[model samples]
Target: MGYQAFYCCYKTDEVVSPEEACEMDLNIAGDRILELLQGDDDFFGLIDEHDTTLQFIRNGDLIWMEIPIPDQKGSFGKHIPIDEVGPLIAGLPSRIDLNDFSEMRFQSW
Candidate 1:
């Protein structure tokens, strides 16, 4: 059996794995995204229960997400930019956007 990696977007009601979820302490995933957004804490701080969108950008392409904002309600993920990714995990953006590469043949998992 082969494990397949998929690029997925989730809404408020959707469920995700532990690894797929963002960290609350702004250490890992959350911190990475914050750096990409140029340290604009307002973007993350302004979020309320009504804001349910979280955007993820991999590579130079845009990924429109629909996941629920961790502690927020009724809010869905939205569009994020790739330039916001930091060097620590910059490759993740490219990996996630592998599907957009015309020269590469993607195999499931």
Candidate 2:
């Protein structure tokens, strides 16, 4: 499979189920995360580990996560533009299906 990257948000308590988590409006939460990641160490540090197939960041009542898809036939992953993140996030559906965590794919190649 090709490389894919995902960005999502959910409650920090981990009590919320996938159904509830999907109901949290990822569009708004994603925007908050993007905004926070800008020139803010505290918000940036929410995500743990720089090197991994999966990484997560927690801030306040929200948690942000990323999953990178690697190129099966090659050693490198696809490239994604940084500028497209905001619009893609803002355009997310009101309800997201995070059960399998496959619905939100902002970048893949």
Candidate 3:
């Protein structure tokens, strides 16, 4: 199977349903997300067709990425430097697999 995913920005609700999410133009959402990083702990989430999820959590002054592990009902998280968000999102493709970011994750659940 090929990679497929949908996105949701808690503040904008840009993609609230599968029927319309359509691989959510990450380029646009990434930019929007970057701009949403205020002190509030807002969240941006990506859930693939397979039910795997990646959550971007905004903290006091930085961001953290949470990727779920379905098999163990656990998750892994990675701290994201505010300055590196642009480059990181820019390097991403429309579809992604968690395994590819193993080096950036640490067990969180």
Best model number under TM-score: 3
Local accuracy of candidate 2 as per-residue lDDT tens digits, 57-88:
44333334444435432222222234444454
Tens-digit per-residue lDDT, 1-109, candidate 3: 3223344555664444434444545566567567655445666665555656666767767788777786766677788777776566656654557767876655635
lDDT (C-alpha, whole model) for all candidates: 0.32, 0.36, 0.61
Model 1 stretches with alpha carbons more than 4 Å out: 1-16, 19-25, 30-60, 69-75, 85-109
Number of clashing pairs per prediction, in order? 13, 4, 0
Which regions of candidate 2 fall more than 4 Å away from where they truly are? Answer: 1-23, 39-78, 93-109
Ranking by lDDT: 3, 2, 1
RMSD of 3: 3.9
Q: Give the Cα error of residue 52 in candidate 2, in Å.
A: 15
